[model samples]
Target: MSLSGKLETDVELKASAQQFHEVLCSRPHHISNVSPSKIQGVQLHQGEWGKEGSVIICNYIHDGKAKVSKEQVEKIDPVNNSVTYKVIEGDLLNEYKSFKITVQVTPKGTGSVSHWTYEYEKLHPGISHPETLLQFAAELSKEIDSHLTSAK
Candidate 1:
């Protein structure tokens, strides 16, 4: 099957769209409270955070298991409140020939909409669609919203 997916969530964050974007784009490995399971660490082999062309290595938990992935910042549009990261190495590369994940925020009233998109090219036809990946994004969005709501 063709492995392409998009997941969107409306988050009522007390922060501005830009602020939310900053948090979303921060090195996931360095953030402490972004998820229920804390990120173990991050190693950036090249460039810097939130900048275009930056490469980041993130270690985190998924399904109660630890996983690591290497990603590169493909695009960062602060004006549009969007950042796209392309997976270049790690476990993700084993299943997908290429994968790009994007997070976009659109402000409305007191809250904002967060859209997470995963575009992937499966390495083989037998690979299943990445529905679980989308679900994970939704969960992360919820966590971010809850964190911001309580911080307000």
Candidate 2:
């Protein structure tokens, strides 16, 4: 595999697209309460919640291993319902030189489609691709999708 790569996952969620976008933009801090099994907590280290340039620290569990990701909100597009996060510090940094995750939601028939795009550069050629992390994000999305779907 290449040292630098991108992974895109489209998860179809049975929830309102606007609501999903709102959750990602304005209410991401509440994600822990909405889906504790996927995310334990999220705190704003700088700037305001859901705004660009904000730094967020996320505590989550991936494959039963606890991980912390310090990320900055790089971009937010309300019209497109997209949010991008660039990871600055955390365990992944030890293995990867840089990482970014973008979440986009689009309305589909009777529901919404979540697009997860992961862009990363590995520290070395021997480092494995971040498939597990992608899986973790997909799992988290599924959990949130269910939570929102059930609440409505």
Q: Top lDDT: which candidate number? A: 2
* lDDT of each residue in 21-136, candidate 2, tens digit only: 88877788889997787789999999998799999999988778888999999999999999999999998899899999999999999998999999999999999888887887
Candidate 1 residue spans exceeding 4 A from truth: 1-14, 27-30, 36-38
Clashes of 1: 0
Q: Would you estimate the TM-scores of all the predictions?
A: 0.85, 0.95
RMSD of each: 2.4, 1.2
Query: Worst lDDT window (10 residues) for model 2?
Result: 136-145
Error of 1 at 76 (Å): 0.3
